[model samples]
Target: MRSRLLRTARCLGRDYTKPSAQALRCSGARWQSTSGREWSTPLAKTLAEAISVTGPLPVAAYMRQCLTSDLGGYYTSHNEGRDVFGQKGDFITSPEISQVFGELVGLWVVAEWMAQGRKSEGVYLMEVGPGRGTLMDDMLRTIRNFPALASSLEAVYLVEASPSLREAQHKLLCGDKPIEEIDIGHQSYSKYADNLKVIWTEDVRFVARDPAKTPFIIAHEFFDALPIHIFQSVPPSQPSAPSEITTPTGKHTLNETARLPRASQTNSWRELLVSPTPPYSNHASLGTPKSQQSSGPPPEFELTVAKASTPHSLYLPETSQRYKALKNSDHAVIEISPESQAYAADFAVRIGGGTAPTPTPSLAATSSSTTTTTTQARPVSSSKPEPVHKPTPSGAALILDYGPPSTIPTNSLRGIKQHRMVSPLSEPGLVDLSADVDFMSLAETAINASEGVEVHGPVEQALFLNAMGIKERAAQLVKRALDRERGASLEKSEGERRKEDLTETVKRIETGWKRLVDRGPQGMGKLYQVMAIVPHVPPKEGEKRRRPVGFGGDIVV
Candidate 1:
């Protein structure tokens, strides 16, 4: 039967696809003023072919196809080689908002290096999802201020999937240094110094970092972009459970999924009392109990959740979540991105390198077992690729993004285009889809990798920045502007030109500072968060006291 379906699919419309393909071109376009949610996409057409050969896929499977399909995946197509970030791009990131953001990041990395005994050896500096190279540019320039630290810097690696963005990074990061294209291909690295290599890859494994030297990884607004899945508990099935769960909230995309009109597929919005049957596990629970004041599901209860990358994988309950109260609430929707978890695990293995981790269990998806688990070898595409070489043992990674402190997620997946909210399904590939990062999950994943790793922070971004002297730095910049203006006015020949330059500089610096530390709800100050992964070494008793910089204040997690 499968063979017959495949044979039929090949001949049915191979030549007929072009006429209807525009409606389904799948250009990776961001959501905007458009309303053809039911239109066919090129990717959807492809999926339809597969479905012809197989059958309708689970909600997660459909989403993974739309976002990661090599043919026209959202990130894969480079958003049509259009800038997806900055003033003119689809959305603006924190680094693009101000140079100070990256400057403080650089200071934090250097301070961590210092705390790790100020190693003079080579240091691995890396950033994941480095948009247009602006953040790294600011960071590298700032690091230059400390000659000693800069001298010890061995390599700078960027983990970026888009080729268009990679070109932008190369142009900006190279500066005045003569350009050199040592290697140019689908996945390549540029050589700046004979020993120093600048690598850009969709997967993290290709970049080599000295395990012997301290490693610092920066992931800003990264985890949220990784694929995620959603689930809801329903009343117990009498004879047998239906293939998929359903609810009254109605179906919508959690950003990545292609929403369709199907009663049996999935629902988008968060709704309560989904089912009376309790499937209690460690990782499953009501997220906010302050309002519930109870530990179990209520009568006729339903709760939406995102457990794994695909609906077809195991939703194993775990016990270590810090927000036990949340899981108890009937209204809560629990979310956890196995995609991000797998990436964290892969990174941990590369840096820690103890016993090679047991291969992750492969998933065999089916209609009836959508919520069940079965083991088999899985594709490496869903997770970060393994590193080229076994990584040196000691490393530190800093992940900064907008999200909660805990590993659990509560309706955090969102879609944005032009900095405004849009339906994740409004334009399919034409919008930015993101969700909150589960820091706790990453910490636990890293801890399980090896004994040499430890986790820290997951602190408020506001606190992290203040501890790193952002306030003082902003003030200094303002003062310098005033000083420059005064100095420029006194010059005889170039006074007018100099003052003009200083005026523009002052305006830029002040505006950028205000936007970065703005106190509004949308502002980055408190809305964003930070987390760190470092080598684990027990401090000696009665040792000279010194804390890891940017982590001096009281921490909740």
Candidate 2:
């Protein structure tokens, strides 16, 4: 059944074995010769050459190369010192929009820590995709206010891949402090906290999981950036063959008769791959919308259905029941991100104990008693040691990103360049690519990966923030600004200028927070969502389970 489903699915529209001359021409037309064409970027040319040599590339492969390829990847490229964040870059993030966003996030972490018994030691703060380190810096500053919780923090871990972004984060989090090479990536002391060491690793897996410690993980707008494999369901074609037939005159003659598609045939999933558009293809040829067409140029790459079943098309969509349910629908399209699921699983395993091996062998083999410390340049760093036994699960992870609350993401791939939305296939490495996250898949993976974890609230960002008290926080900041203005003394004209400046300052603050919690059609609050994973508790017969603060329940401690 599996073989029949996958094999027939790949032959949709036409047979793969014996293609007619017209089919061959159509194939050639789709991916024209690159001889006379000039690509916009070096990476685009490289991608074209590679695709020419080796059939079309998977969307995941294209995204991975465009995003993190060593030479010209959007994030990894040091050429021209590309900046992918902030108003000057492709797009801005929540933390960059307002300080209140980060402050509330920090407060949520502290509140959770206190609710979960406030362990005196063995607590770590980790952030994945810590762009510019602005969120972490804001979070650390807020956490410092709670002496008990702040002192319990042993270390800070930042999972980042880009060298330029890492340096930017280092400069922001740890002013002029020297950063030294560590076994995993690099380590530096954060300027925001007292002797708090910050470690940067390219991947989260590099950090050894010690069930003894509690890790508060933050992934803000991270999952959306992960590469996604897109698949579409189409009616499968029946196998065809040239069968012999007898002529009407009773003479034996050869006839090309194909088998009819069976009524039992159902739609099957086919993976979409990325290939260079036909040479000099215009906006009309590419079928780009008039509203999306820019003065620049038509997209260089386009998504094409694979001619035959690829490994991903055969395997990925079948991995989940959610995808399986939609496989029979001819128009169903789904985007799956294995990287995002893996990261979510890792988060679950770290917070709620797991049996998975350490990412590195040497680290795995290191005895539980083994420990290491940073260089003696500054205050003593936290001791991170592998554990032999899985301790009681504790800690929490907060994921905030844009997507539907409980559905699989479809047709959500998009590109942003200088704030305007563009075709994702336009310019390789030059434009930023992102897709809506599959929150349901993430929750499923997290729960399946760890026995000690429970999931909560794939809720709207507005609901979460309102519950977290964004309005109250914004109000306090406004009051403080007004008080400062009232205490100022100057000449009449000077006072007038100061008053106007203060009024604008107050207005900006109000606007920023409102933008975050706004529920309008284009607002961030409605578009984005928040999810949390924490240690699970066995329910007693008569008592209700405790809920996290931002989700529904109040802080216990």
Candidate 3:
């Protein structure tokens, strides 16, 4: 099958095909190539070169190339709406799974905008890596209910790098609304450029804004996509200690051959057997004729053996000199997200009016005159002044990803193909490679970036959604279903059984949802955590400020 696919690809590459109708429509006159060969196009040649230099790229890179590559980019040749979403796409996200998710997010954004003084004509409803615009569609639909807030939307910024996905977003958003394209000056689109309002980049790293402005940012399952560096711990070593040697008594020594006493009836000790020395020297040797026994202790001795020790000791050896030689024996996995940290810091800085540069002062000469008489004065040297560290603007940044507050016992880095977990490192980019986000490290970075921005949650998604009213929504949905069933009006017995079944089904769903949200030994409640950074505000004289919604007062780290 592999060979067949390769042959087909080679054949397609060699054949001269005309540009598709979609490409011609999008590019206009630029589509006219005198050579009439699509494979010979510069983009195609570049893609071929890339493939030649590097073996099959990682799935992530492949997706990037398919969407953004200059030559034969998927967006140029396909209808974005038709290719993604529905039941035809690679996968469906939570936004596509339900409208409730996006509606809640819309509400969250409106609240954030209000908290930030609500001065601007509109806020940037930016969606990073919006897949097929499903989330945006739902969010916009929800926003329409609040005309005042909806109209405040200065622009809908779809900060997507994938051209295919971007086109889909464009179709979904660029109708009667004012839409501007923010070009990042590369094949990979990262930012949205509008007229002097604000710029939304691919990630927080490129957000061009002032911290005081307090632009509301919303990212759904965004941070989890970032690559994670994984490391494993080394194994421990076994301990070594010196012991005295001894030999069995009543056994033949040199020339004497005699049967020794049975040790616990296991067998007759007829021959001399060397062993480690006993801790207590209590056993006496029975002398025999012609036996030349020396006064010096035997080289070895033995003691009754006990049961084996726990396997944990072998795997986790202590960090002592006795096990120094075997220090590298034990191991555990560790994942680091340096890129995520740097990106977060950059986002914080950019939002806070671009990171201020440290200022350097020039030395100047100063002279003073003597009080009593006229005298020559010399220039005085002064030490350089230390630059001031300005505090970052107060605002909250929430990050939702798949990870825990501490290192997991088992490595969580995994891949999903057709919704099945596959070996993470098996197929390079062909499969998704992700590790659980270390919430503790992320909180530290957020706190370090600005004083007001405090970390929150790192709670389970189930808990978060429930706190945000998912349970209520589910109940409403079930109620509607039950009402529809009643409206059907079946036979008396049938209706009763159906009603009972519906009740049981609703109960089961509620239980499942609860299990999903609450912390359990085997459930998503404990598996997925949500972390948020809220701006710190001083409490009133006797009234405590309300904690951020969806988060308890306690911080994770």
Measured by lDDT, the strongest candidate is 2
Q: Write one digit per residue (lDDT tens) for candidate 1, span 1-557.
A: 45745853442212111112223344444222122223224443444445546443433343443444443445544444466687776788888877888999988777777666677866778787887888888888788787777778777777765556777887787644443433321322333333445665444534543345566788888888765554343222223333344568764333222233242243222222111113243232332223332433331112333322332322322334443344344334555556566556656655565432321223212111111111112123445433424343566788888777865765665557676664443334555667778788788877876666677778888788777777788778878888867765365658777777778887887777666666588677777788877666666898633345676722221
Error of 2 at 252 (Å): 16
Give per-residue lDDT, candidate 3, residue 143.
66
Query: Each candidate: what lDDT?
Result: 0.56, 0.77, 0.44
After superposition, candidate 2 runs with Cα above 4 Å error? 1-34, 239-264, 283-290, 293-297, 356-391
lDDT of 2: 0.77
Query: Higher lDDT: candidate 1 or 2?
Result: 2
**If both were scored by lDDT, which would come out higher, candidate 2 or candidate 3?**
2
TM-score of 1: 0.69
lDDT of 3 by residue, 1-557 (tens): 34534543342222112233443223212221223323323333333334433322222232233333333443333433445334454344556655666666666555555565554553455555566777666766666676665656555554554445655565555433344543421122212222323222333323344433444555566555544333333322223322332367543333111122222222111111112233344442221111112433321122121123222222222312323333343443333444455445544443343332211111000011000011112122235322223254434455656676654313454544344454332222223334566676666555666555556667777777777777786677678777888688689999988889888877755665565466676555666677766556667899876566677542211
Q: Tell me which of candidates 1 and 3 scores higher on lDDT.
A: 1
lDDT of 3: 0.44
User: How well does candidate 1 match the true structure, expressed as C-alpha RMSD?
Assistant: 12.5
